[model samples]
Target: MSDDHASSSDTTAATPAPRSLDDALALMRDLRARCEWDRVQTHASLRPYLIEEAHEVDDAIAQGDDAVLRDELGDLFLQVLFHSVVAEERGAFGMQDVAGALIAKMHARHPHLYGDGVKRSWESMKAAKAKRSTLEDGLPAGLPSLHRAHRLQDRAAGVGFDWPDALGPLAKVREEVEEVASLIDPATGAVTNQDALEAELGDLLFAVVNLCRKTGVHGALALDRTNAKFVRRYATMERLAQADGKTLSTLTLDEQDHYWDAVKAEERAG
Candidate 1:
């Protein structure tokens, strides 16, 4: 056969593989129709589980487990199909509609790749589509404070409503610290105005998060690493104390400090 004919013959003889998306959608549809548990579920009912699966995926990524990440991602994808299938039963939209909207959105966002439109910033496109008047309007209210602060700063910065340089945020951090200090009694070292102390402390943390954003560091990830480090050091101290026939609670402050210092020394030696 000629090369073109041979290619065509090969293409015709090849068997088509089943698509995972289609299989998943079929599974969702079947569950929604027959399974009592799935049939009773609604978008509102599955909200918490969707959030949980997303966090599980994040945890899996942090643990550096590809198998767990893949499994968690599959669970997360199932949430999408589940919600779409639920909507389908209510005469709304289905997975195809969800996918089509996403595809359209991505194409619209990347006009340089798909159309004769000029490339524009993602924030600009998002702002144009957003109904809210403020930059921080669309952010979820339940987001962790640090993440919310980071995103809020980012949104504001996108519109040039930000400090000029790293120094600005660093200076802001100092100012916030001073404000927090003012909320405490100078002699007693006790927080006199609890409410004001809370607010000022929040401002200090927000400033630090902004500094993290400007310095190309993720505040949450930095905090997570610090937390892990603390846990490791504390556990080492506990093990050392146990070896010396003592408990951490039984040690004096100075003695505990000695073990803590020892742990730091060991870590540095390693």
Candidate 2:
């Protein structure tokens, strides 16, 4: 039966009741079977759509528009239904099974609520769940190098596998900076040792991210905020330029730098 027909039937029943999750799954299954386009969908073919929908959701979230976010979230959710319906047609578990498994897993993981009644701090909870300490266990291999380095150091430090205090990391970062400076050739006015300098610079950055992590700051979030601040300030400068019947593209680097400084000074003064 069509979803509309099923809804009408349920609503018109003598007894009153809320629609169950299974009812929604049943309607999705019926729609998949009867709709010509839906019947032709395969897992491999739907992968692109799933990815696109997820990115749309991300875009809406980034824009900070709740209304667009709600609609985008619904579209992303349909991807879940589409996948489950396809799986069910192939004799795999349906949406109910998916929901049940996720619910069970969540309950199992949250021991303070559903398992042993022990109060747990976030750090203690993480330490309990972490079961390994090798390089492989430190961080996922696929994260961007900076982010991976941050996570790697944070995980290590959590288990007493780190410097005794903040001073140690601070000293190491200073040492890295000195090494990177030495790798530059002053007489030649060029980098004499690119590899060594690059490695030292990377170490310095990693140490900074680690320090941020240890101090209860997120390196990624801080960098993102800085990026947004720069974008906003630059856009403000662009508007000022447009008001003068000029564009940023027509401005020299020095001219732009002056405008940027003025903008930053104005913010500080305000």
Candidate 3:
């Protein structure tokens, strides 16, 4: 072989193909060193990807396909690897430190398994570690509003500040809806004080979320399922309309209702 060919072969042989987590870490370190886009990234710059990948994993899980779930999980892992590599570059810590910290936290939380102390609730254990002005003070403001509300309710429930049953939140939901309705003109359905409507709607949603929590359902996941259902049904309606040489917008409200009912019946029958 020519000298260039021999040198290229040696370079290729030096960097083995990744087969495990250690290899993934080495690969990430190499990308940070050599790839232009990867090299320029910091934890701050990649923050959005971290959140986006997590949501993608959520989507994949909702879809309930193992293949898609595995791919999305890997995408989420990439975000973890990216942050770990970035921190390593800054001498803050590396993947080892991240894994070690997690293991330590697990051992502390599950002392029954690891030996020494009894099992403790994760949230209560977390609260014990912090000194906060209020329960909400420790929560990140950037959490999705629905998730934030859910977490806030969870924290309150941790301190015995919860309704005894779903009925309480169900009643609160009705009250919030009534408060919201009071802001609207009954005759024309014109909403007065749009800001008040928005606030009342928020209250209504919070009450609904609380009800969902009391019912042992995650509000976010439940909403996600409902959103997906709506999209599917609407798409089916649109398809049915197209089959009749019309679009949903071209149909009268009653005609649209017919299509919606048909879709619902079809779904039920299926």
In terms of TM-score, which candidate is strongest? 1
Ranking by TM-score: 1, 3, 2
Report the C-alpha lDDT of model 3 over 118-225, residue by residue, as the tens digit.
Answer: 876667766667665788986777888888999999877866789999999999999999999999999999998999999999999999999999999989989888
Q: What is the lDDT of residue 71 in candidate 1?
A: 67
Compute the lDDT of residue 194 as modeled in candidate 2. 86
Tell me the number of clashing residue pairs for each predicted model: 0, 0, 0
Candidate 1: give the clashing pairs: none
Give the clashing residue pairs of candidate 3, or none: none
Q: Could you estimate the TM-score for every candidate?
A: 0.85, 0.70, 0.84
Native-referenced Cα lDDT, model 2: 0.72
Worst 10 residues of 2 by lDDT: 4-13
Question: How do the residues 145-243 of candidate 2 rate in per-residue lDDT, one tens digit apiece?
Answer: 767877677656666678767777788788888888798876876898788888888888988887777666778767877998999999989987887
Give the Cα lDDT of each candidate: 0.82, 0.72, 0.82
Better candidate by lDDT, 2 or 3 = 3
